[model samples]
Target: MASLKGLGYSGGMDIAQLKAFPLFAELPDAALSHIARGATPLAFPRGALICRKGEFIQGFYCVLEGVVKLAFLSPEGHEKIVDLVHGGSSFGEALMFLDRPCPLYAQALTRCQLIHVRKEAILPALDRYSSLARQMLAGLSRRLHQLVLDLESYCMQPAAQRIIGYLLREAETHEGQTREVTFPVSKALIASRLNVTPETLSRTLSCLSEQGLLKVEGKRILIHDVERLRDLGPR
Candidate 1:
């Protein structure tokens, strides 16, 4: 098991970055500074299990850097990749307030840096900072809205469209100005997130390539026509 590190933020991060998140947007500088003071930074090796399902909640975790996979493993031992959380995104927040066991596991897909926030410490911060409460509510609401969108896509869209839609959204949100979009996760992992078979995913990608929509260079996808891919999926 990897050990947690004390909060020793080497080069100071601009508190403004947290402000970009609606959950931390309203937090006053002093309050943000306080929370930042209390937070612990931890390192995770690639493929490390950061948190396991059903484990007692230690605290809420926020990804400070690198990617983390939020997933559920089946009784038969199959794992489903649910969400790939990026930097600035948080997890275990909703569960921190809930009474039930966590239904999912969180794993670091690469060497990652994370911050831990103890639940017991949250109320005082909220009391001292009205903006913190507002930010938390907004963050939670955005997550809920995203879940609804995922549900709607699954129920109302066909498989091809669903896959394409997801890829396009991913493409748009992809960082940098480069034409080639690198898939951070493996194809099998991506297939699991898309709720499709690996073979099916390959076939679909081939089909997309044949239609001149994209060029697959290993894990990187060079999107040839964004509008066409957008049109492939249901609106």
Candidate 2:
């Protein structure tokens, strides 16, 4: 809800919990301190835009808390959800690395805290810290893998399979079989991520529910059969 200066994160979030992030986990104490010196923390309430399309992105950002929705807007005023980024996940790297403006808008889906390191500051830190370099490389590799998967989904998968696959992947990666993984965002936003119309998504979910594959109770989704859902992946 407040800006970085308002949150009192004049230094980076250099805590043990930060180590849980594979990207920042291996840095030496000195490097971590250097990073901490320049980093700042900010908070956003749900539905607030952290960054917008065509804005000049200055650095890399990691979620210290809550979830963010990365999305794109069409010239005709259509919103397409691209990714749901949660805590420990990072974004804005593409713009930072390429020295270009942001291509998508990042909005907070829940009240959130975030830490950021400017590109200028990080370059010197990375030069002195091989571990940091390795971490960056690992992050890039992971991002590439995700991109490949997304491209595959867009190019080859049918809408039914894509929607089901999205839910199953979210369940595995983010939900982990909790009583019911809260559907963190609206179905319309989710339909955009899966490249389907909201009506189509509703119909697909109804079909799945009718078949005993899943139960949609308001915003919560109970996955009755994860493997059956997984099998919805592309052939």
Candidate 3:
């Protein structure tokens, strides 16, 4: 278990950092400053539980650094990773408005710095900034689409194809024939996210390696044939 640090409503919250998020990018300086005033900075070390299933929602959380795993526990006590929220991303925006308990757990995959934007602050900001509301809706819609894709993959696609699709999507930011991807969280967590057992994930990677598609070294994966891997991905 990792120790937690709470910086309660830091008065020096950065307006520029808030601007970097698409949700607040278009807001005027005054609006951004208003949000900054109510934002609380929280630090969680690796393995810290940020939020738990059924916990009352406090506010929206924006990841400033490191990664957080959004997950839920299975009936058999297994932790199933639903999504990995990385730096520059925000979570719980929709829930903040709904006034309900969180449906999933959020845990720090590594040491993390996060901003908790209080619902009180956000509600008034929304009323003042129409663009912010649109961006929030757009963000929620995108999240829904991703969930639908995940459901489709789980129902209709093979495990190997799902893995290939994940790798290809990760490589999209880079331009090259070969790319290296370091799993931000443990391979087991990724396996859970992809709805596969750890052993199954290993076997699939081994199969891909034997086919000269990619090479795996622990958490680091090196794609040797990007085109072939892409071809194997979901259509």
lDDT of each: 0.73, 0.74, 0.82
> Between the candidate structures 1 and 3, which one is better when assessed by lDDT?
3
Q: Any runs in candidate 1 off by more than 4 Å, and if so which?
A: 1-22, 156-235
Clashing pairs in 3: none
lDDT of 1 at 49: 82
For model 3, residues 1-235, the per-residue Cα lDDT tens digits are 2334444544578899888887888999998888988888888878888887887767899998899999887798866677889988899988887888999989999988889998988999998889989988888998998787556434534877878888887777556544888788999999999998888889878877876778999898999988666645785
Best by TM-score: 3
Question: Number of clashes in model 1?
Answer: 2
Clashes of 3: 0
Each candidate: RMSD: 11.0, 10.8, 10.9
* Residue 13 C-alpha lDDT in model 1: 47
State the local distance difference test value for candidate 1.
Answer: 0.73
Candidate 3 structure, TM-score to reference: 0.65
Candidate 2 deviant stretches above 4 angstroms: 1-20, 157-235
